[model samples]
Target: MSHVSGDLVRRYANGDKGIPADQVWALEAHMETCASCRQLLASHADGIAPLLDTVWAGLTPAEVPAKRRRLSTWITPAGFPWIGMTILIAAIAMLLDALTVLDTSFVLLVAPVAPMLGVALAWNKNADPMYELVAGSPRAGLELVLRRTVGVLVVMIPALFLAGLPGRVSPALWLLPSLAFTVGALVLGLLIGVTRASVVLAGVWLLVVAGPSLAEQNVPAVLHPASLPYWALIIVGCVAVLGLRADSFSRLLR
Candidate 1:
């Protein structure tokens, strides 16, 4: 496993607040999953031992418990609003479908990209105010990314299912595509960052599928049953790429 530099750990443990925030964030994030680095941090902690003891003594049992309840590693509070927005968008699409406002399947068009918005927000630095702390947690790498992705899927899949109930679109048409796009975002995210990757994928979907479908007043051929195998292939390929680049998620910038 990659480890933090010894000099950086020593500076951090010596209470050197002058360290750049990005470097600090990276170090903390790396140490969370690296036992050897954690040990290195402990070795350098003697310099700050007295301060730690004093602070520890100042905290009362009641005050300790008064801290906010720990959130699940699967999802952060920052992701909740985006998830709700995604559900709202699905509901709106369903409404449009029910009212026959659009000739094409609006529900199907929206379903595949719905969960992606939430996945983008899941670990985004700009979206999550507590990103530093979250990144510094023990679950900061691909495990954390997968957990948050699962969390997004858990809420979005049900919402999409209910939304599609009012439309003629079959779940498989949208479901496989949704999973494919979500995992594809992660695969691309290893290089470009999750938020940008998601935006690019969504934009491409709108241009290639949703736009043409609406203009033709018909669901695109890609959303047809025959295309399910292609979507499945994309998902499998993205999953394999994600597995190979798993370590990329440990960095602060991503």
Candidate 2:
């Protein structure tokens, strides 16, 4: 691969706005794979060393500890509450199922979208206070998004599994749909924001599947064993698209 020109590296390191967006993107993307170019960029970035030092100098000794409590890049603090809420909702659904309060299995109905609550907040601009700084970083594209999404799934998948135990539903019935919706949100998020994409997909599922399933007191065909393959196909397709458009998340607009 051709290395980026020194002038472009200097301008990028200096935060020059005159450079076109595409060039800036290409340069950053290239730097991720090119150690020599990254070293060159680091050298150019030395010009900002004094500014950084000045900012650090302005901080008082008393305030240093507070500043050190930096947020995790994988998942925002706001995501915890949403994750908690999802778990609580799943428990409630399980309770409803055990009590025979609803003819349709509430556990299965809620399983697919349970992780969505956490996923939506995973990279939400509003939920994350450090959105600008995090999104502007060189590694802030698909990798960061996937990290946060995995963090959510790690917690949610087990919770959903246990919650559905009482309903005796096949794991595939809920697991595949959950995976599909989660990745589908990310795929659509390349066009809309993740938060909006999550909401839109969840809303559609509730309307088209959950609502009808509850109203008719029957499990939706989409959630049946026969539909697992289709859900798997959707997941594969969404993942492929996400890989192709991975750069989209790096933009501030996303």
Per-residue CA lDDT of model 2 for 26-100, tens digit only, reads 988999999999899878877888988889888846543545676665666678888898999999998888998
Displacement of residue 176 (Cα, Å) in model 2 is 0.7
Model 1, span 177-225: residue lDDT tens: 9999999988887778889999999999999989989998987899889
* TM-score, candidate number 2: 0.71
Candidate 2 lDDT for residue 35: 100
- TM-score of each model, in listed order: 0.73, 0.71
Model 2 misplaced regions, further than 4 Å? 1-73, 101-103
- How high a TM-score does candidate 1 get? 0.73
User: What C-alpha lDDT do the candidate models reach, one value each?
Assistant: 0.86, 0.86
Candidates in order: C-alpha RMSD to true structure: 16.1, 15.5
Clashing pairs in 2: none
* Model 1 ranges with Cα > 4 A deviation: 1-70, 101-103
lDDT of 1: 0.86
